[model samples]
Target: MNKATLASALGSPSAFGQSQFAFMRGNAFEARVKADGGAELLRLVHERLDPEAPPPKGGAVPDLGASGPEGRTARTALALREATGTGGWTLLDHPLLALDVAGSPAFLEPDAVVVHPDGSWTVVEIKSFPMLDGSADAAKVGAAARQSAVYVLALEQVAAHVDPAPRVRHTVLLVCPKDFSNLPTASAVDVRKQRSVTRRQLERLTRIEEIADSLPEGTCFAPDLPPDRLTAAVESVPATYAPECLSACELAFHCRDRARAQDAVTSLGRSLRAELGGLTTVGSVLAAARGESGDPDDPAVAALRRAAALRSEALGGVAAPRAAAEAVPCP
Candidate 1:
C-alpha cells in the first residue's frame, strides 16, 4: 500500500494540487542539465563546489535503473559504493536513499548526487524558482534548504552502510534558472542548520507503530466503508488541527469544520491560543471581554476588557450598539 494511505490513517493526509506545470518545468530543467553525459552539470559542480580542484574531464553516468523501488534503491547503493571506492567524480542521477524515520523507512530521491574524487558526496537540488541577479526568494531558498537537508540525512544513512563511510557534505548545490532565461545558475547553500532542525524534528516524531497501538480495537479506515462508519473510524483517532495544516493535509477541511463546530480556540491559530492564556474558547474570551465572568486579575482577561471598552467607545453610537443588540446574550 502507498505510504500516503498510511499517513491518512495516522491523521496526516496530504492534499492534492490541480496544476503540475511547475513540476513539469522543474523536470525539464533537470533534464536539460543532465543532457550530454551531464557535461553542463559537471561544469556547475566544478565551478561552485570545487573551484580549486581539477574538473572532471568526463565522468561516468551509471544507470542504476531497475524494476521496482527496492531494486532501484539497491542498484543505487551498489553504484554509490563503487563510486566511493574508485575515488572518482561520479554522478548518480536520481539516486534513492532510504532513511529510518520514526521507526519507518522513508525513501528519498534527490535530484542528483556528486561523488567527489575525495569520496565525499554532495547533494544537488534543482528548483524551478528563478535566481534573478544572483538572488532567489529567501523563503523559496529556505524551503529548498529544508528539502536538501532531508536528502543529506538520507545520504548519511546510506553512507553508514558502506565500508569506509563517505562524507556527506553539509553544503548542497542549489541549481535554478538564471534570471528569465533557461540557463542554470548554481549556488552552494549551507544546510547545517536545516539539517539539525530536520534531524531533531524527525527524532521527536512519534512512531507510527505507537499511534497504531493506541487506536481502539477493531477500528478500520477502509475507504469503502459507510459514510458514518468511516467518519466514526477517522474520529476515533485524535488530530491536532491548526490553520497551517490546511496547506499540508487533505483532512484539514474536516478537522477545521469539527474544530469550529466545537469552538476550539486552536482553529484560529497557535499564536492566538498562546496570547489568550487560559481563555481557551471564543465564547469564554468574549464573555470575559464583556465583563460578564472571569478573573479580573488575569492579564489576558484584563487586556480583553480594555480592548472591548476602547472599541465600544470608538463606535459608541454607530456599529457597536446594533452589533451588541443582535449578539447572543452570554449564557
Candidate 2:
C-alpha cells in the first residue's frame, strides 16, 4: 500500500508538504530558465559542459506528449534515436524514463535533458536556490547531485536499447538563480560517486514480492479500512525506522511513535543505534550501564558501564536517574 495513504488512515499525515511560496518561486525560476525555447538553458549547458562545441544557435524541442508514462517513455526513446541520427542538439523537456526498482518499474520525469552535438546526453536539474558569488549551498548541491544520479541511471537504461548507445554524461548541469537575481547560472556537478552508490543501494533492496508474501494472510492497508485494522496491517510489515525517514517517508511519524513506545534505540538515529549494539532499547542500555544487568564481556555494555560510572563520579556520587535519562539517546 502507499505509505502516504496509510499515514492518512492512521491520522498522522506526512509533515513534508512544500511551501506554496517556495513552490511558486521554483516554478518561476524553471520557467525563466526554459524560456525562449530554452535559449538560456542551452547557453548554460554549453558554457558549463560543452564550451568547445559550436555555440548552440537553437535545438529541437520535440513534442513528447502521449497518453501515459509508458507512451511518453517510448516517445522519448524515439526522439533520442532520431536526434542522435541527425547529429544535432535537442532538448527533451520533462522526459519520462523508467527504472526497475525492487521488482517494480518507477517512472521518473527530470526537468530537462540535452543531447549534445557529439551524441552525448546531459541531465539538467533546475533549482530556485541562489548561486551567490559563483557558488550555491554545498548541501543543496549534493542533494541535487544525488537526485540527478537517479535520472542518469534511468537514462542509461534507455541508452542501452539504442543502436549506437549515446554516452550519458556523469557530470550534470545544475541551473540556479544568479546571485539573488532571476538570471540563471549553471554548474557542472560530477555525480559518478553518487550514481555508483545509489545503484548499489537500489540493487541491495529486497524484492517487493518477497516482502508482501511474508505479510499475514488477508492483510489489507486500504485507507478506508478501520483504524485498528489499518494500523495492524501496517505494523505486520517490519520496518527499520531511523531519524532520516522524516524527510523521505510518509509513515515516519507513525513509526517514530512505535519506536519510542518500545524504547527502540533507532529512534535517536542510526549512528547511536549502531553504537549501542545488542542493547536495542533505552531501558536495557540503562540497566547494563548501571551494572545491574548484561554481560560484562560485551564491549558495548562495558563502555556504557564505564561512561555511567564516570558520570556518577563527576556528580560526586549523587544518584542521577534524571541525568542518566537525559544522557540516554532517544527521540
Model 2, runs deviating above 4 Å: 315-319, 325-331
Write one digit per residue (lDDT tens) for candidate 2, span 112-212. Answer: 99999999999999999999999999999999999999999999999999887989999999999999899899999999999999999999999999999
Question: What TM-score would candidate 1 get against the native?
Answer: 0.88
The per-prediction tally of clashing pairs is 0, 0
Runs in model 1 deviating more than 4 A are: 1-15, 18-20, 312-331
The per-prediction CA RMSD against the true structure, in angstroms, equals 4.1, 2.1
Model 1 over residues 206-257: C-alpha lDDT tens digits? Answer: 9988988999989887865666777787788788789988866777877887
Compare the candidates by lDDT and give the number of the best one.
2
- TM-score of each candidate structure, all chains considered together: 0.88, 0.95
**Roughly what TM-score does model 2 have, to 2 decimal places?**
0.95
Candidate with the greatest TM-score versus the true structure: 2
